[model samples]
Target chain A: MADAVSTPQEIETELRKVLSYLTGNADLIHADANKPFKELGIDSMMAIEIMAALEKELKIQLQERDLAKFTSIKETVETLLTYVR
Target chain B: MQALKLNKHEILKHVPHRPPFLFIDRVVDLRPGKSIQALFYLDPAADYFQGHFPNHHVMPGSLMLEALAQATCVLFDITYPSKRKRRFYAGSVKARFLKVVQPGCELELNSKVISMVSKGGVYDVWASINGMDVLRGEMGCMCVYE
Candidate 1:
């Protein structure tokens, strides 16, 4: 289970790790968190990969509607916060 | 869930593909909204064999993916009956080809939904020959209402 007190910053950090691994772009840690995934070189397929990876790492289930909501890291972190216990 | 089988005639009603382009011949097992197992016969005289390799003919890898995609479409149709009118559009796919598929082989296609929403979903799909794994991958698809 994720830490109940996990802050958005913490979630963002974890998300950066996942994105870096999936895209093989280590600089994502420093990249603008608000940048859209498309501008960051992530496509729809990669988005699905990210979602699947997050589900496994966080031990959470994301709904289908959440797939289209993966616009940016900041936005994704906020969405994840709602699901994380 | 209990497995439901569909013959070629029944499969035609659910799948829109036709001869030459149609990869699946019959569905052996189906669990709506979850998973499906189908089969395809790789005929030796298929037109692609004439140039695919000349004397050493082999089924193209892309077609294998198409077969998997078609199976996924069938699963989606059965899973969401209300969305039967919608067309399935394959979005993105990540696949690994483990073995070469040859002519006259019976391809066992299988697909399982990993995640689904009202409009689309992601699926895990694979195909095998004589129980030997040939290809496996993850595919994303959308149901186009148009």
Candidate 2:
């Protein structure tokens, strides 16, 4: 099995990769990690896409409830760290 | 996938979803406990299209998955008739929508039962239009006995 996300830095890097791809690089530089995803132009569809991509790359399956709880990059990384295996 | 066969009336006997919500239109071919090929004719008149996108209308990916789930339920119904009344709740889904399905497109959906638990099952599902894959994924559902 693959190692789970163990550190905040690791989680942020992973999130950045996903967010960059979903929101496009033009907006990535201006994105505030603490702001809600909506402010960063990440819609529900993009959020789902990011989750799918992360699940595949991380080899981890996240629950639907977990998806509902993380609305910002900071919250997402924090939540991911809690479940990082 | 074969031509048209089982109609919505027949499918309704198995699944609980109704008009405007039921995404399945017909069952092309099905092998009990094995696999199923179904169809959904995306009607522009459907309510979802009215708001899904005002300008560029496209069927929701989540609903497409629901269509697959309904088809899986039909397979389970034929495979395990005794458990027909059990409500199968989608437990998890790992899906990717490769193409945007628009109104008036006929969706060809196919699914195969990959695993079965005492009260649930997992299905490998794919959806296509004109022989091009639009979506594919793995979905699991658990049975809730009433």
Highest lDDT scorer: 1
User: Tens digits of per-residue lDDT for model 2 on A1-85?
Assistant: 2356568887777778778865666566446889998887775545555665667656677665666656998898877876774
Comparing to the true complex, what docking class would candidate 1 get? Answer: acceptable
lDDT of 2 by residue, B18-43 (tens): 88688898998988767899999999
| DockQ score of each predicted structure, in the order shown | 0.39, 0.03
Single out the weakest 10-residue window by summed lDDT for candidate 1 chain B: B80-89
TM-score of chain A of 2: 0.83
> Candidate 1: deviation at residue B109, Å?
0.6
Clashing pairs in 2: A4-A85
Backbone clash pairs for candidate 1 read: none
